[model samples]
Target: MEPVPLAVGLAALLGLSSAVLEVHVGQTSVVSIKGQQAILPLWYTSYSNSRPFVSCLLERRDPTKHLQVLTYIDGKSKVDEKYFKHRVGFLYPMPSPNVSIAINNTQEDDSGQYMCTVNLGDESSTDGRNIGLVNLTVLVPPSSPTCKIQGTPHVGGNVTMSCKSLSGKPSPMYHWRRTGPSFQVFFAPVQDLSKGTLTLTNLTTDMSGTYICNASNSAGYSNCTITLEVTPAFNAAVVAGAVVGALIGLGLILLFALQMFVYRRKKKDVQEEMANEIKEDAVAPKTLSWAKSPGSDVVSKNGTLSSMNTAQDHKLYPSKPPSDTASVTTATGSMVAYKPPYNNPRGGTLTPTPSLSSQSLPLYFPPTVNGIHCHHANVPVHRNAQHRTNGAQPQAPRQEHTLPPGLTSSTLTRMGAVPVMVPAQSQAGSLV
Candidate 1:
């Protein structure tokens, strides 16, 4: 390489600053932990131990106060006037008369600044004076950080949290928050890298939200965040279920009450209709007429069943009036047995009174078999009630009649069910 420029060479040498030079009071420079009396290397862009320096300039960053520092140099106590003595007057403001800096003891008062300046008559230059301490520090290992919460708890069971640095000279600290609040029912704390764990216990809905964990060391600083949540409990749900069940039961009770009211109303309506029909029939005119009829079962217009009759026998059959035996024990309730009129073919005459017992007989017994009917009252049963055969009546003609399906028990005397064929070709309602 070509010969380095003089200024470049000199600047490079100053850059190799030694801790043995003079105390460093500049803002960005550093000193050792035991640097109270520290001597920092002095760097000159154009001066060295070999080359003579002209003067030093002392000025604060803001030089408003106009401080005037003294002038001095180290190692000038030798008896050679050529090396130590200065013939010129002292610099503008001298804190003390000329004294060699090497032999002088330094104090906090002496710690301010001094300028060592020289004059080479033909050239003039200046160097900055760095003075005043910033108290630099060399680092050792750091201490552990401590932690705590902000308040005891705000809500009844909720808590607040935070943390701090305890032993480190540089103050290492941390913070803490929980896990995810929006998704899960539980949460965990995230501790700072250099601090103790952070935890939240007995969480509730009040506990849901964000949390923070902060970590700081002498090296750097960082932080993180977490969220928390809580689940609903059984006690809350029980009351809700009970209220719903009670409402349903109350509705069922109301429906049952409405049905009972409707049933009773229908029963009263039917009873009123039957009572009105009875009144009309009782006011109808009475008549005395007679006619003959075949044994035919009669069905009353009032929906009652009666006995059977026959035309070939020309029998005089008269139905008795209502007797004291009108009382009936029925499957449903008490019923009344009423008397029906009678018919005779012999000159429309009434049967003479015989000394008949007060006991009245049934008009017709039901058919013994499928097609055979018997007139139970037409034949006089003189046989002893104890010595009677299963055949209660003698057989007549073979006029076959059959009962409706499943009506074997309901086939009463055919005559009572038989219509009075007198009004032939009349409408069914008109005959009734």
Candidate 2:
């Protein structure tokens, strides 16, 4: 090969120097027990006492004042007389490149950040690249964590809980567990674990129990417990049921009252109707008949004989009457003149008139006594109209009769429709 170019040769030399100017691989944080020897190992990749001399400086992390612990160079070392007189020194001399240091009889104050820095010289390219920190933490077991819950524990509520281990060599990690019939551990999420707190979402009855918080570090573990009691909330189903039951009960009571009111009103109406019918009968003309005709079709010109013959056939009455006016039908469907004996003015008597062809007929009463106005077989009665008779009238101007208060002709007809037992005296009186 031809002679190597000078510029390319210089570039290769600089790359080789950069590769070898790094800190050693084994140098890392140091941990030890109090009152024991602690070692802070540090080394460089390349060793030389030539142009840029090698040196190592140890520093402690102090903000107000820079605390320089030791300085080692040229195979010897110097330490701060006040803090590290006999406690700190180099482990090996120059030419060997073991820039490691040690602290004999390490105290509690030695547990802090210790930085080891190596320098070739002011003009060296790797000035800050060879620096590292040996974090020194003295051994101490974890203290018992003080566990506490922060909020009301009820169903559907969220609560926060905390655990703190006050003393440990390194910061302790915390885990929560529940103690009951059997042990139940809680695996908190990553977010909760970072803050050493447990957050329970949508709490339930099952979560109420003795809770334990375990704290651990490199030295040992410790735990503490707190009892948790969750209160119950109102049940929606029970409240809704009570409201519905009350409404149903009220409805039933109202319905019962309405039925009772109707029954009492109907009973009072019936009693009043019977009394009025008795009074009417007491003042009625003795010539009036309760008689059936010869064949339900024929009647005598003498009303007395027909009344006597029909006294035994008292089954013509109905239990209930129609709401509309009563009507009488003849063979030709004609409405006939029906005159009540009370209206005759002849002391309730009738004159003997010529008999007609036999046909079945009902005894008709006039409209005067109770609003019992008659309607034709084909016509309807208007309640709002003043009632009038349809038959031929006498020469005298007649006087109209008014019904008793609250009494209508339909009501009177309904009362008359009810079956009544005629005593023996009434039969004898009728015969006489």
Candidate 3:
């Protein structure tokens, strides 16, 4: 019981002595700009006779981690070579009560909580106020921003204007305004400050102007500018009318082409028909006529007498007169009219008679009279030869006849000789 009371009294005394030594640092947070320096103020009070050991540390409140910044023991000081290195140093030398530190060339990543602690030499006491805290902030100004317009800037339409900054320490706020043709400045009705967007609805020609966007933060601000142009809406009636007119013109052109093609085809057909008709009319029928002989009568092999006068020949033939005529003397001393050489209507020349002479007579005469088949012996015509030699009257040759089995010459003459109907041959201009 006596030893326990002594231990209790010793613990009370130690607590009282530990409470006398304390570490102090600025309570307010420090603000800094990037690429500049910042100072952390620190001090301490100690009742002990000897100097105290001090330590400075960095605390990350977000991730809840601790890092050693520096430590001071005795008269010598050491900095964390890996983390602080040349970037951090004590404002005051070692063995001094002040343990303030300055950070050079600060960056955004260096901003965080820092702590200072002091301990008496070899005390190992837990009951005391020997800790201090500080907060630091590094600010970065807003960089140059880009301005853009989205959607069609047309009358009765809507559009969106946007601004953006690539870098800033704190997120920047945005504002939008427009400068008219007369240089009048006005703010947009619909805009988002944080998102950096401005919206314009039911646009008009009056809305055409230069637009400005400003991005700002605690450090500084930057701005960008763009232009918008609105135009009148198109007229629906005029567009429709133009389209209809073009379609009508195209239809007319197609109709004209079709008509021309049909007209050409019909004309060609008519020409072909006319040509066929001309070819059909070009052919004419051929006729045959028996030439008349004066003061002579034709006798058949049947002892039939057929006398054909000029009137009777024309009545029987009833065809167009021949174009050319020639007189020929027969072996009986009679002049017979015949056609001369001429072109046949179809093609080729008519079969011409051979040269007449006293030695030979025609074997077959063309255009026989009344279907009579009369044969004359090849007796030389004495009249023609005699006439040619001495120009004297020559005697006519005597005719011989082979009478039919049932007919006589006297009976044939009394009955006026059966008129032989000689039909024309089928071939054009052929001789028999």
Candidate 4:
């Protein structure tokens, strides 16, 4: 039992001595810039009197496994040419307690946990205590940020000022401040530090000026500037009123044009109606005038002097007889014989008989049996003796008269003037 207790005590002492020879790391974390060098520190204390064979290795710790970065064995050093190549090497010669390694030309992909393991000759301690850990971070400086203004910079409107960096390690923080004479450090505007934005509410003209944004991280800082200008608000009411007034004026003009069009159309219609009435009146048939007595003068509606022959006058008034003494009577009436005086060779007028003189005669006579149209007031009455006989009356001779230009027989009849057959001899100074 005493021997068993001594063996256990000795085993515990050996484990303590081995633990004292384990590797120790300095600075659990390290930060460096890209394209620079990084150092993973490892050291150990010697417990034995004589020199011991030291073998060490540096590995990168991954989520799945550990990757060999560098190795030292038999006083020789070798790096994983597949990954680290010549960029990774031991900082000091082997066979010493210091087993630190340097990684030159570090990149972003080199940022990860690194471990250093040490082993003594023929003493491989699998207890996992002879190892050192270091976390490396390759930092990238903040780039030059871009400043921009968003939203309309009008009075009483909300606006946003933004700052952006194309690349930065550990994400840069943003700070916004106004520059120029209006700047005040304590009066910094409200901003989102993570998103690099500054928000302004209810903007005013006084806020117009140069603004600057600073993006900073542990590595370095970059700044950008922008100018803000707040303009006066637009007057929408005035524009609307002007537009409405223009529309109203245009409408009035159109309405006036429409009224003018309608008035012209109505005026044209009235003129056409009046013209049609005049045309109807002109085309209407003229009525023949009725004489009250044979001695009465016939006048047309147009006030033209007109006379009709006994045949036409009797047809209109069958009970009346013509007043002319030379006119032949019907079987129911008595005829008054007329004897014309001889015409004077010097064109002197002959006295008419009382019975013929009492009758009103037409101003002009139709053509006589000699085919001569004569005026009662100008021509002398001429009688031929051969036209008369005792109790053997000759019929009156008919004559045709050529009407004046533009006058037809129907037009003359409408005017109450008709040609009639008359005796060649008439009462002296009496119209035939």
Best by lDDT: 3
The lDDT values for all models are: 0.36, 0.56, 0.63, 0.61
Clashes of 4: 0
Per-residue CA lDDT of model 4 for 1-432, tens digit only, reads 133234345656777653344556767898888789998776654454333343433344555545677777766777777768889977776566666778999887788887777767535555676777888899987899999888988889998889999988989988888887488432345788888889899988898888899999987899999989888777445666889999999999999999999999999999999999888889655443443423224322222222333333322221211233333221223333323432445454222212222233333333344564332222223333345322322323333333345656554334333234222234453234
lDDT of 1 by residue, 1-432 (tens): 112134345546777432112222223343332112333222222223332222323234455732333233442222224322332223222222111122112222222233444432233443423222222233222333333454333233444455554433345556454444543222334343344455555555657666555556554444545444343544445767888889999999999999999999999999999999898889665321211232211223121211112221223232222222223222223232222323334323221111112222333343364566654433322322355455545543333223344334223222222222111011221110
Models 1 onward score TM values of: 0.23, 0.33, 0.49, 0.47
Which ten residues in a row are the worst by lDDT in model 1? 423-432
Tens digit per residue, CA lDDT, model 2, 285-338: 454322232222333343234343334332322112111223333334354443
The worst-scoring run of ten residues by lDDT in candidate 3 lies at: 301-310
Question: Comparing 3 and 4 by TM-score, which wins?
Answer: 3
Ranking by lDDT: 3, 4, 2, 1
Candidate 3 lDDT tens digits, 41-109: 877655455777888888886665678888888768888887678999888777766777899888887
- Note the residue pairs that clash in candidate 2: 292-310, 297-359
Residue pairs in collision within model 3: 370-420
Scored by TM-score, the top model is 3
